[model samples]
Target chain A: MNQISDLITAFLEQCERTPKHIAFSQDDRQISYQQFEQRTKKVAGYLTGSNQCIAIAMDRGIDAAIAIYGILRSGNSYLPLDINNPANRLNFIIADAHPVYIIGIGPCPENINIDSQETQWLDLRDLLISDFSYRNVQIKTDAIAAILYTSGSTGTPKGVALSHKAITNFATWAGTTFNISQSDHIASLAPFHFDLSIFDLFTSLSCGAIVSFIPNRLTLSPSKLTQWLCDNKITTWYTVPSLLSFIALKGSLETRPLSDLKQILFAGEVFPTPQLIKLTTLLPNVNLYNLYGPTETNVCCYWPVITKQLQADKNIPIGIPACNAVLTIDKTTHELLVESDNNFSGYWQNGKLNTVTFKPQGYATGDKVSINAKHEYCYHGRLDRMLKCSGYRVEPAEIESIINQLEGIETSVVIGLKDITSGQRPAAAVVIKKGHTLTHIIKPLRQKLPAYMFPCKFTELSAIPLLSNGKVDYLSIEKKLTH
Target chain B: MKPKIREFIFQELIFVANPDQFSDDDDLLEAGLDSMGIMRLIMFIEDNFGVTLPDEEIDPDNVQTLNALEKWILRHKK
Candidate 1:
């Protein structure tokens, strides 16, 4: 329990120390540390390490929470595939990662072309807790604990695999930095797939703190979400900047007295200064921390927003390094290079580790950052065409490729439009093929892409404007869409 | 009013393959209208319909479907 490299051991130690303490609570259901330990052990018995990886398609509740730890306890990594995502994307990930065990509500995704003989599907209903021996599976050295898939430029999602050492290091740092205690009640808002979930799940539970699940249904209603937070007396909360902004805008913070909320941590995308100012104004006493990192390096830098000095004129810097992260800016590209203990082992592709992510110097973060007057890092956007839509990292190249593949599309350029709600929404400018109208492209595009990636605005351009060097003119397209 | 609601939702808030085929009782939340989309829907309602939806009233029961949304807006519009 003394900040060991093994996350499961730390969690187990905490469970022993505080067996009666509330571990996970959702809606009316609450699981104590002792109950969760018994449940996790029981669930682990079902997992035979025949396949080293498993895909959990369960809803974001008590079952999904138990399944993740159980899988890890069985010496296997897990991918918590968001069931809300388009089936096309989910099937792609299932087929790509090839999880031999699929623990979910029903049958594995019909589209996955896995060897039926090798695969096993365990229904949540069937896994009843009774008399079962605890499986003390020996975890291999440098074994991956979780695999998170992010939008890739190659028109497919890339899985960033993290080892137990890396996540434990992160959990220890987060627990120490935030002063998480047995008394603290933390809110789990971010979905399992996101990197933010690491702190929400591992950091809170491992530190003997109660982690409250924000109901999936309540996520869409900010006012109700605000009420839920106050009612729950959640001391710690972590999620994307957009959701925080949504709550501030419509949550009616004026009416709700969230006296227990001591800290708010936001990451995954930029927090607009205006909305940020509004949040600070609403919650004057609560501490605000802007956590910054790519999936490659989990939370390398962070900035604690100082309330009085928060000027609308100046943008909030990503701030100094955290979790023993060393940072440097490339002289030529000004790209932020991160070498951190929390850095992922590598991308998981075709059942092999893709270690090509690290450059000669360090992990070349696609993001370009510049140091502010206070020597804090200020974001300068992506070095590539990657865009953030509502904290979801989106690649224009990927969307363009999807669009190009559709029938009656000559070529398309996808651009991110500045949006107050989502930070940016993808917009497309396309030159349709002969005998094709813009209407023809809408249905198929929606079917293939998730709602976040769908183009909010589509333009039927005769010919896309070009630079002298033959690149598609992005500035021209953005202007046309806005006007 | 329902037509205006449909137009605004389909035009900016969400994507329905056939807006015409989508019934008034259809679940907008299931249709991928998230928190941000709901925020925009409120703004659209206030701007176009001149009805200010109180923050406390922004619950799933009121905004789950087109008919429910229209009823909530009309009740507030009065």
Candidate 2:
């Protein structure tokens, strides 16, 4: 238990200490630490030694939670595939990672094609009922614990692998810094794949706090979402800014009360300035923190926002480094460089990218940051064309490739536009072949992409403007739209 | 109002293609409209139909289908 380098040991210690305490909760169901331990052990028995990489494809429920713990318990890395994503994208991930085991609901989702010989699917119903005792496996500190794939610009998904050492360091740092305790009830709002969930899941477990899930069904009705938080007595809440903004705008929080909330942590995308100000006015007693980190380095810096900080004309500063991370700006490009044990090992099967991402010392975070007068890092934007829409990292080049592959599409380019509610939205501009209308391109694109990735708007272009370098002249297109 | 609702589903919401194929009782969530999409639908309803949907009226069972959506709209519509 004193060995914090191994996350599983630290988590198991909490289970031993508080066996009857609630570990995780969904709508009407709650699982205690003892039950969680037993269930995770059962899942581990089915998956151990079968694959180095175990993929979790279940919905957001108790089964998915057990699968995650079991994968870690089995000493294998877990890859969480979003159940709502397009089958094409899911198939792409399966083909790329080639995970040996896929744990999910029985009967694979329609249109998803997997290599049957290589991949084994384990139904959650069967896994839960298996009569197997907990297996104690030797998990090395350097062994990969989780693999998170982000959108790649070149039409492929790049996986970022985090070792047990990295996540444990982060979880321990979060637990100590946030002062998480058994009395606190933490809300798990972020999806399993997002790095934000790491702090909610591990930090809470490290301290024996109950982790509550914000059900997807309740999210649409902001009032209900607010009600759930108050009803559950969530002391600590973590989610992306867009969801917070949605509640502020749509949820009648002004009339309702949330006396139990102590801390609110937001990250994954830039929070709109006006929404932050509005939120501060409503919840003057709550402590708000703006977290900043890419998937490569999980939450390296954070800003504890005060009322005055929200009113500042400038962007919020992503405060100094946490958990022994050395953050510095590149001299020429001003790109952020992070030297930390918390940084991921490297991208999966991407040796060329490893050379670029994992430099001689640390990971080269492509994000650019500037030091504010308060001596904290202020986010400018990404150095690349990557965009964040609804907290999902998007690549315009990826969408453009998909569009260009469609029949009757001559050329295509996608752009991100700043939106008031969702932070940013993707918009596509396409030049069509003869005998084609804009409507012709919509159906195929919708089928291939998820809802968030779908273009908010589409424009028809006679010809795609280009620079002398033969690259698409994106600046001119942006200017034209503005004019 | 029903026709306008149908048009909005077809035009604004891209998830439903060939609106004629959709039944009145189809579960919208199962049809691929996520939580964000549902919020966007609420905004569209408020803007176009001139109705302010209160918190209680935003229940999942109430807006699960086109028939339910139309009934909900009729109840709230100005």
The C-alpha stretches of model 2 lying farther than 4 A from their native spots are A1-3, A132-134, A350-357, A479-483, B1-51, B59-74
Q: Over the full model, what C-alpha lDDT does candidate 2 score relative to the true structure? A: 0.80
Q: Poorest 10 consecutive residues of model 2 chain A by lDDT?
A: A348-357
Candidate 1, residues A1-483, lDDT tens digits: the string is: 344876688889899899999999998999999998887888788777632778898777788888898888878898888776677777788777878788886665564445556557887556645456765876653789999998999988889999898898888999999999999999997888888999988998888999999987777778889889999999999888889888889999987769999999999888888889999989988999999998878999999998776787666899999998999999999999998888899888866566655775678898999998788988988888898987889889878988898889999999998877547888889989999877766677776787788887777899999999998889999998876
User: TM-scores of all models?
Assistant: 0.94, 0.91
Q: For model 1, name the residue pairs that clash.
A: none
List, residue by residue over A1-483, the lDDT tens digit for candidate 2: 365787789888999999999999998999999999988888887775822887889776677889998989888888989777788788888778878788887876665577657788888778889887766898899888888888888876778888899999999988887889999999987888878888877899989999998888777678888988999999999888888877777778888769999999999898877878888877888899988888988988888886776653556778888778998888899999888878888776521124234665477778999888788888899898898988989888878887788888998888877764656677777899999776755667766777777776677789989999998888877665434
How well docked is model 1, in DockQ terms? 0.55
lDDT of each candidate versus the true structure: 0.84, 0.80
Say what the RMSD of model 2 is: 3.2
Structural similarity of chain A in candidate 1, as TM-score = 0.96
Ten-residue region with minimum lDDT total, candidate 1 chain A: A110-119
